[model samples]
Target: MPSYAYRCRGCGDTFELSRPMAEASAPATCPQGHEDTVKLLTTFGTVSRGGSGAPVAPPAASGGGCCGGGCCG
Candidate 1:
């Protein structure tokens, strides 16, 4: 079983539920009993960074700065 985060579209309430992966998701609702809702994209606490490893953001400034002047100046 895994935990999933769901957000209510009616009252903007966020909640988490734990259930089996094969089990169908229940209709999420607001605390006011509104049935109009949706499940948000699931995210994990810690992602495995083995094998290919995690992606790293590129470093800033690729040594292309030209003395605080425009490129064509």
Candidate 2:
């Protein structure tokens, strides 16, 4: 079973559900009993350790990209 995230448009509530992948796209009822719910895009976070056994931080975003005030052309 996989976990799915959903948000209720009726009450603005968020929730998660564990179900078969086949029904992952099925409509879900919110915890508050709202039927107007939609699945939310979810992301997973991973932790990496360095040689010293300390958690490694992610690299900083490059400042030369289109959204970083750099020319895209």
Candidate 3:
């Protein structure tokens, strides 16, 4: 699951939601019965698991390849 930011075009209200990636672009409306709402591009306040907190993988170490067998070929 991921969290996203959304804004209401009718009432100018902004909010966040934890939804599936497929539903991120679903039709959403304001609680005030305004159907003219649109999603907004906003930065997240903090990095959480549902947001930018997604983990990043690290590169593997090769222990310094081709060391000449400790003195010669």
Candidate 4:
């Protein structure tokens, strides 16, 4: 199930709901009992299985095909 964010116009409250994608467009009622609510556009984050916390990938090993093998020289 994916979580959808919504904002209430009557109470000015923001909330989230988890439901099936089929019912994503369904009407949402805020906790303040406000029927006037609109779904907010949310961005999904990417998942990285990398162990390092760095933003970029690790550098390649010194021993490689071209330069390491001295082919370019």
Better of 2 and 4 by TM-score: 4
Query: Candidate 2: where are CA atoms >4 Å away?
Result: 48-73
Q: For residues 1-73, could you state the per-residue lDDT of candidate 2 as single tens digits?
A: 8999999999999999999999988889999888999999999987656577677689988776667756665
Error of 1 at 7 (Å): 0.8
Candidate 3: 10-residue stretch with minimal lDDT: 64-73
Better lDDT candidate (2, 4): 4
- lDDT for model 3 comes to 0.75
Q: Which digits, one per residue and each the tens of the lDDT, describe model 3 over residues 1-73?
A: 8877777888898877788989989887777777787787866565556656667679865445476344443
Instruction: Predict model 2's lDDT versus the native.
Output: 0.88
Ranking by TM-score: 4, 2, 3, 1
How do the residues 3-42 of candidate 4 rate in per-residue lDDT, one tens digit apiece?
9999999989999999999999999999989999999999
Candidate 4 residues lying further than 4 Å off, grouped into runs, are 51-73
Clashing residue pair totals per candidate (backbone < 3 A): 0, 0, 0, 0
Comparing candidate 3 with candidate 4, which one achieves the higher lDDT? 4
lDDT value, candidate 4, whole model: 0.90
Tell me each candidate's TM-score: 0.49, 0.62, 0.51, 0.66
